[model samples]
Structures are given as structure tokens and as C-alpha cells.
Target: MKPIVAIVGRPNVGKSTLFNRLLGHRRAMVDDSPGVTRDRNYADISRFDKPFILIDTGGFEPVTEDRLLQQMREQSTMAMEEADVILFMMDARSGLTPADIEVAKMLRRVKKPVFYLVNKVDGDKLEHESAEFYTLGVDRFYTISAEHNRGVLDMVDDLMDTLPDVAEPSDREELTKIAVVGRPNVGKSSLVNRLLGYERVVANPTAGTTRDSVDTLFMCNKKPYLLIDTAGIRRKGKTVEKLEKYSVVDALRSIERADVVLVVLNAEDGVTEQDERIAGYVHEAGKACVFVINKWDALDKDNATFGLYVEKVRMEFKYLAYAPILFVSAKTGQRIGKIIASVDEVMEQYTRRVSTSEVNRIFTEATESHHAPLAHGRRVKFYFATQVGTRPPSFVIFTNQPESVHFSYERYLVNRFREAFGFNGTPLHLMFRGRDKKTLARQAHNPA
Candidate 1:
């Protein structure tokens, strides 16, 4: 799991600005759709040397002063509890306030490393003004302009150096970690039991390989898989009854550990708000996921029922357009075999790699089919594109006007790539960058 680094501060202190700045290119995709609050605040940040999850606690618009401060206090307290590292931001322009001191006091109590940040320090003058914050603080503060990228890199670099055990992607190809997560009693245990009873492996799992979650090694058609089920895992002194609500935390932990997630939904209940949030977390985490509608036997179906259900799911999870959905009954064991078959196929696409020439060719065709609209009176052009990484294949597309490229056009290019090469059950990241056409041409001719 990537370490979660959160930005917590009072309203209008540039928390969101710093969040967007840290995100860089991934910003657009993270804030893709309107009305998606969960995704808007949390982003999978990987551009930097040390990757982490960046959370913006300042998601709301400024309200009445008293209420906003109250909200900020609540937000800061919650952030301190959850985040691995906390970034306490104070506005250099506004100067230190009672709220900043209150938040600082809270931060002082936490065992985690709390970075004191004085934002909006645009110049040496403001940097000097930022020193007023030191009255309540013991350690030094980093003065930064989150909007202009001033002193932000230095702060992040120092924080990264201080943070220990950053979760880097493993090079070794090991057992595929599959997590089964859903609302409590949503047939999570039933499905896990069925799967284990059906395909539990002969040999015991090696020692010293256990995760915080309960993991069982199983085989499907001679292939190995390590099951990370949210249901089987129990927190100390927490009863199964309490787990209904508490399992959400466990589910998130399971997601962080798994490469692929099985977002199981109870057919009788249909799609709940919790289900959508859980699935949204999977998408946010960039894990290849499949939606399993469990207890399909309970739902009385007509010819139109399945289609209607599928359409509703598509509507709810508009962002997860790529994930494959399966209608299965863990009780009946109907269509059980299809689960692994689909997983195998999806993994193939999830870890798929397209050659640079082919990647550029598809983008070329995509633009030819629907030319990217001109932005700011200049014609937008794509010089070249190369698949940078795969685990949800990411591409860095060199373009003349990187900033001018519209989000819709980027989405169009993503659709085109998907059409040409099926990226089923996976998300695609297309990062636009500024590169000269001459440079691309030289590289193209040389064929590195």
C-alpha cells in the first residue's frame, strides 16, 4: 500500500492548491467527474521519486468563519488519526491564528511526523512574515506557494526522506493477491468459503509471508492465488456484529495489499452507498477490479432484469467503465467457474504492454479520427506516445501544448486506445508532456 500523506489546514490556506500541485498530471484524472467527492479528495500520486496517496482535507467551499474553523478542527483531528504523515498548513498571508495554534497543539500530541507548512509564501517578504508561526511551533517551518510551486518540492523531499518503509511495487512475480471485499454479510464470507472449499491448495503457505489480513493460498486450474478476504479477518475484541461497520477499514487494508479486488455486491440489496464508496476506493487505488453481484439467486429476474441491473450499475459507477461485472450466486455455485476465467483474462489486460510504435500508432489513428480541438488559438498536436509502465498501463504522450489539451480530448484518446487494445478490468493513465517534434522525430528515426 502507498503511504497516505494528507494536507490539513484551515479554509483558504491553499490546501487544495498544494494537493493539485503534488498530484501534477494525475490531477485532471483524479478530479475527473463532478459530484464524486471521495475520488476528488484522494489521488494515487506516483509522479515523484517516492509514490504515496495524497489527500486534500479541504474539499469544501469557505463558509461562515466559526463553522469553517470547527470543520477544520474536526478534519485535522481525523487526518491525524488516519494519515501516516500529516502536513499542517498555515497561511503566511493570513498570519498565525487561534485555529492554527489549536491544530498545532493536536499535531504535537500525535506520534507521527507532523510537517509545519506556511503556505502562500510567494517571495522573501512573505517568507519573512511566515516566521510568526514559530511562536507556537518548536521545529522549523517550510514556507511555500502551493500555487506557484514555491518551496513545495523541498518540503515533500524532506518528508519522503523522513518517512520509512514506503511501499514500492515488487519486481518479483509472485502469487496474484485477490481481495474479496463488500458490505458485511453481503455474502463476503459465503463467497470466500465457497471459493476456498472449491479450490484450497494442497500445500501449506510458507511461514513469514502473512499479511495483517487473513490470507489463504488457493489454486484455480493449477495456478496459485493468495486470497485476502475482508470477512475472515477480525480485529482484536471486535465481534462479527461490530464488523458490519468496522469491516470498511479492513476492506481498505485488503485493497491496499491486493493487486486485484473482487468488489462483491449483495444482489438482494442491489447497490448501496457503501458499495459504491468501496468500489470507488478500488478505482482510486488503481487496482484492477471486478464487480461480483453475489446472491443472484435471490433476485427474481425477467429477461429485462439483468440488462436493467447492468445499466444501473454502469450509471452508478460511471468512472469504472473499464471494470467487468459478473452476476454470480455464491449460494448456488452457479457460474462459479467463470469467476477465475474472467480474473485470468482481466489480469492479462491489466499487466498488458503495447510497444511504443503501436502505442503511438493508435494515438495517431485516434487523432486522425477525431482531431484534438485547438486550445487558445493554437492547434494541439501529439508528437509521440510511449507506454511508460503497466499494472494499469500508463503512457507519457509528448505534445506541443500539454497544458492546452482538454480533459475531454484526453478521455477521447483513452477510449481510442481501449478500442484498439482491450484494457478490460483496468484503468489507463495518459500523461501529456511538452516535447519538441524534432526530438520525437530523431528518436523515431533512430529506433531506440
Candidate 2:
């Protein structure tokens, strides 16, 4: 459960710049593209031993004057409601304007902590010029330069220190979260209602009906389960595209927090490029997944239709070969009941752990079948292996030449480990650690 920190301000106030700067500054990290912050605003930021979500409510330029202030106020208010901590940034070069005063009035109503920041205050001269913004009557404000990295970290340190660190709820461990995601108008919400046996979420025929990811706590056979229903994700060229209005924060956040993801595909559309991108996201996150082909009843299918569809899905999502596929129709109540059982089975595999001796035995047998290839004109030697973690069952293999381990060999070992141990419906991570001292393991994408 990470706290969300949002940067809200008028257009051209360095919100997005600061958002991207904070992403790489101060040891914070995220798996996706951090530098491309044109409209992709939400990212999970892990910095200073504290993990939080950063959202930038920027990009409201080019609008008519009559709508700019109204839109800015709406965006700021919405961000304030969603964010646990708010960073209200202003441009010192442009000085304070009427729009800033209107936003500040709205911030005064918020009970949460709001930090004021004046950007573009590069040197001592600009710092003094920033004094004009004090008329907004803020308790305190810091002047800094987001581009050059001045006073940004000091503000974040104070914000993090002010936020109280609390333990996650004990009951959270009892719920197995499943996030349902797909492109527009894929029957995700309707399918979720069918699973819950009620209309917990509003279901409409139009595309983009659900704006936020809604959660519901349910029980089946005395076991608790949580379902995260999200809106359709936008596929922008080769990357996932999003704007401030159509933010997919909850969709990505649900995937991050869930134990399993339900990648819904429309039966009519088959496997579109957007569906492939959605599956890729789930795979990259290392979560167990199930492909649910919705609207099966609407399709005119014969005896061989299911086989053809399965073959097509296998060809498209070859990376998720370990995942199981289900052809269900929310309209006709077809095969939807099997979803929970499949999730239960996949959950077992996702959290599966293997003993160290068994791990070594598998490695020994795998190496006997196929040997490591020569790299850089040197022979690589494998000494030992051990299981270090689970949730994808990560292992560390000590070897003489970790950097020399071929990528093909890493993939081979992963397949062999999966074949020997029945770790279906989950990815495997095998890190190569060098036997010599002072050589840290540099493996990031080997066999994932």
C-alpha cells in the first residue's frame, strides 16, 4: 500500500519536468519508461526506502481562456482528492496569476498536507523575485529549479518525513486480488458483475464507461477475494499512451498490487495489437495471468472453433504460455464459474517455493542435458545454485563467469527448471552471481 503524491499546478509550471526529474533522482526507480513523460504521468516511485505513486497533472496548454482556469481548477481538485500528499508548484518566472490564486483557494479546503513550491528560481536574483508569490498566504514555500535539480530533494525529504509510516492491514494478506484489464468495450465490467453475481459496478454498452478502477471484496466457499475492475487502456503506437483526463493510474496500480491479472479479450476482435500490449504489461510485472475471451456466446462457433481460437491465442501470446485460457460469455453465463478455480490454481503456482537441494538437483540435471556455450573466447563454469525468493521463484546461480553466461543458456535453464518443477502460470528469474569477490550480479533480464 503505497501513498500517492501528485504534482498539481497550472500549465507551463514544470510539473511534468519535476515529475520526471524526481523519478531518476534520489535513487527512485520504476520498470517502465521514465524519461518519456509527455502524457504518461503515473509511475510507482520507490525512493529513500519509501514507495509512493507520482502523478503529474500538467499539460493543459493551448486551451481557450474561458476554459483554462476551469479545467485547471478541476484537474487540481481531482488530483488533490486522489493524492495523499499534494505538491502545488508555481512558476516564479511568470509570477503568480489569477489562476494560481483560484487553485490556492481550492487547496485551502483540503485537510491533507500541501507543500508549496516556486519553480525556475535558478539563482539568488530569481529567489528574491519569488517573494511576490507569498501573497497566496501559504504557510511556507521553497524556491527551486526542477531542471538543474536544486531544492527538489529537500522538499521531498520533508514531505516523506512528515508522512507517518504505518504497517499494511493484516486483512489485506487474506484477500487474493485479481485485476481485469483490456482495450475499450471488452466486457470487462460486465464480466466482473457476472463473477460477483450482482451489479456492483455500473455496466454500459458504450466504450470507456468505467473511468476508475473499482474494488470489491467477495467470498467464495469461506475464502475472501478482491476484484479490481479497471477501464480500458489506451494503446499509443508502440508504447502505452495516456493523458491527464484519461489517466490509467488505477489500471497499472491494480496490476502492480494484484496477485493475478485477468486479461480480457473480445471474441469478435480476437487478439488485437492492444490486447498483446496489455498482456505484455502483465508479463513484465511478473504476475500470474488468465486470458478470458469474453462474448463467446455471440460468436457463431462450430465443433472446431474453440480449437482454432486457442491456437490463435497461443500464437499471439506466446510469452504467456504458462497461463491458462478460458472462453466465457458474461451475457450467457458461460464458463464464468471456472475463473475462481483457475485463479486458485495459479495462485498456488505463483507463490510456489522449492527446496535448495531440489533446485540444485534440477540445475545439475539441466546442465547435464545442455552445456553452457563459450563467451568472449572463455569457458563459463557453473558451481552451485540456490532459491532466494518466490512470487516468481527467483534463484541465484553462482558461476565462474556470470557475464559470460549466454542468453540462450539462461532461457534453457529456465525452461528446464519449469519442466522439472510444476511452476506453471508464473515466470522464472535466475540470476547469475560470480564466484569471485567484488563482481556483483549484473543480470536483470536473463530468463525473465
Candidate 3:
């Protein structure tokens, strides 16, 4: 776990802009519109070899009766609560408002260090406009422009000195990271809370309530696992807000880092294109996956309903045919235990290794069943095959003509490996490589 640094401020005060500037990339959504970022978005940033988790949250709404605005306020407040250090931004152009003063009062309750940033001080003319902010009685402050990246590094230099030292968790076995990802309102957070037996993440009827990819440490049957509850991923066309766009990126990043990704689908809605797209990310990343069809209780169930729903998921995610599917109701705890069981099972296969002799035996049987295709009037000669890596079970085959090994033949070889050793709920990476003279000599002396 990295130290957390959160950015909080009133609406349209350039909080997101400063967040992107600090990240040195357009990760947080920025726009002239107020409240564009409704939820918190975080990323890992390293400066001068020091890494920390930087969180970009929605603008702080001091007082609002609107349902969404209140939710956004709660989201920002949560960031401030979790942050080791907080950056409270104010717009220099707008000078000072009662809302900013109220925000300052809110920060006063927080014991953590808060940095006052008067953003949009692009020139000397606006520098004087930031002086009045001292009325809030903050001991230290900086006049900077988040859009132009002016004086931003100076603020970071000071904040770096204040970051608290975090001790890492000492566990004998590495924690298994499981990322739960799906479209908006798909019961992702609900599933997380169910697994944790608590409301670890905010789960509402509203779409996109959980914006950030929040991680929670979980222990099940004496096994430690990190459950990453990610934001709802919207389609590119529907992701108009810059905040939501970055939220999607954050969710995808969580998937990339996960050992096993739980691709949650809403059974009430059936399988949609976006669900398949999310599964595509898991497949592309070569991560082990379990298809979790949530909201099963909401669907009208009959004798064949479960089978029909499973078939629908299979049809939509045909590429992920190897993944295990579980029909779970997050609201009712229906078959939720099977998710963890599947995760453990998949993880075992994900890191499974095969001996060189076993690999050769499987390869020989596969070739005997269906010989290699002929290229240039000669059969594509496969010399040796070995397991090069795990975590999706990677294998490399040394052949006379690597290019001559067609994709269908590669698929056949992968199927053979799966049949020999049940590589369930994981992808197989089979690489065809042609041997060179030096490599062939080395292999002759020390065979793979």
C-alpha cells in the first residue's frame, strides 16, 4: 500500500487540473463545467523515486440538498478522510467565496496536513488576488496555475516532505488480488460488500456511484486476498465527461494488476456489448477470470432460467469460454461462496507449472493426433516445447519454421495442454520460436 494524497476543493477550482498536472498526464478529467468529476479517481505516482497514491476527487460541495450533489460531497469527504495529506485548492480568479471558507472549516476538523493552493495564478497580476485567502489563517500557501503547470513542482516538493512512512503487510504468502469490474449499476460494489460482509464501498441504485478502484484486504479460510472494487465502466460513446473517461481507465488499470478478475454481469439485463468489452480486457491482459452474473434474484427464475442465462453469457463472451461462470445474487448471498472457491481454484491453475518431460509428452501426443501443417511442401517441424512462465501458463515451442505454425494449430496445441493438465479459468500463451545456431548449441548441451 502507498501513501495517499488527496486533492479537495470547491467546485470549478481547478482541482482536477492540478491532479493531471501532478500526474504529468491527462488522467483526471478536466473541464470548465462544474462538478464534472462526481467521484474520486486515484493513480499511483512516483517522483524522485518516491511513490504515492494520488487521489483526484469531486469538487467539495459545502452544503447542498440535491441528491447527487450530496453524494459527491460524501465522496470528496471520504478522500480527505483517507488521505495522509490533502491539497485544498481555491480559484484565484474567483477570489474567495463563502463556500471556500466553509470548505476551510471542514478541513479544520481533519487532523491531517492540508496544503492551501490558490490555483490559476498564471501571472503576477493574479498573484495579489490570492493574498486575501490568508484570511482563512492557513500557515502555508502557494500561488500556482494548475493548467500551465506553474509552481506545481514547488508544492509537490513541500508535500513530499510531509508524506507519512507506510509499513508493508508481512504475510507468508503473497496476497491474491481479485478485481471486480463491470458496467454501471451492475452490483459490483454490492458483491464486494457481500464478500467482505460489510459495506466497504458505496453501493447505490445510481449508476457510477463507485468511481474509484478501492481495494480492501480480505481473509477467507485462512487465505488473504485483495478485493479491488472498481468503478462502473461506461462505453466510450456514453463516457462524455472527462472524469468518467478517467474512471474507465482506472478500472482497466485495476484489471491489468489483478491476478483474477471477476467479470460481473447483471442477470436482469442479460449480457450486453459493454460486458463483453470488459471481458475482452481480462482476456487481452491474460488474467484468469470468473464470470459473475449478479442480480440473479431479480430475474424471473424457472427450471431452465439458470441454464438459459448461462447460455446467454457463453454466447456473448465466446472468447472467454474457458472462464468459469457463477450465478450469484449479491443482495441475497446466493452462491457467493462459490466465487471465492472459484477464485482459489483459478489462481492455483494460473500459477501451475508443468515439468519439461510432461510438456514434451503433451506436445508429442498433440502432434501425433494432428500433425503440423505443411509449408513449402514440407511439414512444419516442431523440435521442442517448454513451459517458460506461469500466471496464465506461458509456453514456448522451438520449431524449424516459427511462421509456418498456423493459429489453428497453435489453438490445437493449447487445447491439448489444457486437456493434459486442467488449466481451468486461465488463458494459455503458446509462442512459436525458430532456433538459431547458438541457441541450438546451448539447447543440445542443456536440453529444455
Candidate 4:
């Protein structure tokens, strides 16, 4: 797992700006508006051949009653708790405020390593003013301008030295593979941070912040699992950068390798066509899938209304009617643990096997319920069925006329299999082949 470096401080201290600078792009939204980034932002950062996860905490405020403000505070506090090293940013131009001191006090209590970054120290005058922040008892301080990209590389170098080396798991075969995917800026990385108990990727407000496929491994309940954070998928015309173009391709490749894919969706936006397209890819790849409704705290829905949203999702993706849907607040770390349990359940289903007798029984009953279509006045005959593989639950069926099998008929059989044995959130593959030589000979000669 990558080391987590969290940027935390009072509002408008250039935390977001520094996050984007270290990430080598304008991923985080940069504006004069205080608390523009109310949610935690993350990105995978590398410097001098060493890599770590960077987190940009939302502006730290001293409010606890307002719901939204409380959510932001929780997100920032979570970042601090999970960080391997905390980058405590402060403004050199405006000097320190009471809020900054309060934040510093909180950081001092935590045993984790902390670095004081005095941002906006553009010239000698601002550099001289940066000294006042040393009273925060953070010990070391770095003077830099995040907007101008000055002294950012030095900070990266210093953080890289503090990161602990990641060790490989002993039982690689037992590792549960989970991929975090969604449309741009839906807190995919933020969710990843919660799962790994730290920030292993950088989160930003701007769309397409993550441009690489980052993998982090950790254990939940003594079972090791790998979490892959991927770039957001956008429509064809929306992508511009060469790096981003490759990143999208890499994200699809990660989906192919994943055992369970968590489709993260923004609760405020609801489901869209692009989301359906992404869901289609997971189904086509024959992988177990789960729907994660992120940022649920932002949605002003009561208990009854939230239930309706889940029902609507099931209606939209009828193919995955059996797949589980989890509503979570990545910002507040709400129900984040449930996401891991859901992935584990789906993975169990993916690797499950059925006996030959059970397979034949289900196939016979399904075929008897609705016979295969007639081909040239001859009814298609489906013979014995047997399990051939797992990790997608593949099967082979011998038939009198394999060519006569229709795609719709295959779908019906898959649905029947789901009904008999719970293959929730998992895709199934069925292969049809002729049992007799004459039937095979005819198909080979016709070449249709």
C-alpha cells in the first residue's frame, strides 16, 4: 500500500492548490472561494521514483452543528487519522488565524508525522512572515507558493523519505480483487482512502483527476484484498489529454482483471447514460459487480425516499437485478465497511461451484419449461450440462444443434441459473457445442 500524505489546514490556505501541484495537473479546483472543495480530494503522487497517495482535506472549520459543515470536518479529520504524514498548510500572506491554531492543536495530539507548509511565500517578505507558524510546534516548515509550483518538489522529496515500503501478501491466491470505478469526480479515490484506512490516491474537485490505475493491498478481517483506483470514464469527445486517453483504457483493463467491481455513482446526479455504459462493460466482462451510491449524505432524502432510489436503480439495470447496492458517504466514512463486505460476498458467489447433478437438474427443468426454437422444423435438443470453470462460473452444454441456440435462449438459461443458485453480482458464461459428429460436420461445412 502507498503511504498517505494529507494536506490539512484552515480555509483558503492553498491545500487544494498544493494537491494539484504535486499531482502534476490542475486536478483540484482552484478559486478564491473558501471551502470550494468541501469533500476530501485524492490522487496518486510520485516523486524521484518513489510513489505515495496524496489527500487534500476540505477546508477545516470549527463548526459542529451544520450538517454540511460537519461532514466536511469529518472528512478532514478522517484524512488526518489515516495519513502517514500530515502536511499542515497555512497562509504566509494573511498570517495565522484562530482556526489555524485550533487545527494545529488537533494535529499535535496525533502521533503521526506532520509538516508545516507556509504557502504563498512567493518573495522574501512573505518568507520572513512564514516564521510565525513555527509556534504551531510542527518543528519543520517549508516555504513555498503552491499556485506558482515553487518548493513543491522539495516537499515531495521529503515526504517520499518518510513512506514505509509496501510488502507483498503471503497467500496471493486468496487475495480479493476489488476495483473502484465511476464517472469523473464521484469520490472514488475518497472511498479508496476509507477502505485502506489512509489516502493512497489523490482526490480533487475537477473531473478526471486520476490518470492512472493505482492498486493498494490491505487486510479486512484477516483476509487480504487488493483495491484498484481507476480513472473516471467519460464520453468519447470529452477526453483531451493523451495521458487521460491512456488512463481510460487502463481503467477498462483493470475492470477485466477485477473479481468484483464497485460502480461508484454520485447520489446528487442519479444514474445517467454514461453510468449504464460502464455497467455494460462489467457485465460483458463477466465479472461480479456492486453498485456504490457515494456522497449519500449530500442527498436530502428521508428513509422512505432513499428506498425508492434503490428500487429505481434495480429497474434501470435489470440485468443486474440480483446485484447488491450500497449507499455510503465517503466524506463521512459512513457505511464504508459495508462496501467491503458486499465485495467479499460477490467474490464468494463468483467462485462458487455447482455439482454436475445439480447443473443437469436445473438445465433440464429450464429447458422443459421453455423449449429451444425449431430450426428447419427440427427442434433444437439440449443434452447434458456440466460445470467447466469458476471465477465467472463458466459451463458447457452438449446439444443436438448448437447453431440453433439463440442469444435470447442463452440469456434465459443464465437467468434460470441465477434463480436456482444465487450468483448475485456475478456474470455467467455458457458454451454450446454439438454432441454428434454429423451435426459438427454440417456446421463446419456450412461455416455460417
Candidate with maximal TM-score: 3
Predictions in order: lDDT: 0.71, 0.77, 0.85, 0.81
1-448: candidate 1 lDDT, tens digit per residue: 5687878776667776787788784231122222111111456678878787776664222234554333444544555566899888888987988867876776788898888889888898997777788798467888888888998899889987976666555773467878887655666656766776632211112211111134555677877787765642233344334323334454677788787889988889888787787788888888888899998999888999999999989999998988889998877897877888878877888889998789888888888888889898889988888888877799888888999899999998888888889875688988989977788888666644
Lowest lDDT sum, 10 consecutive residues, model 4, at 439-448
- Candidate 4 residue lDDT tens string, 336-393: 9898888888898899999877888999999999998888899898767778899899
**Number of the top-ranking candidate, with lDDT as the measure:** 3
- lDDT value for model 2: 0.77
Off by over 4 Å in 4: 1-173, 437-448
Candidate 2: which stretches are off by over 4 Å?
1-173, 237-246, 437-448
Ranking by lDDT: 3, 4, 2, 1
Superior candidate under lDDT, 2 versus 3: 3
For candidate 3, report its TM-score. 0.86
TM-scores of all candidate predictions against the true structure: 0.56, 0.60, 0.86, 0.61
lDDT of model 1, residue 59: 29
Of 3 and 4, the candidate ranking higher by lDDT? 3
332-359 in candidate 2: lDDT tens per residue? 8999999999999888888888877788
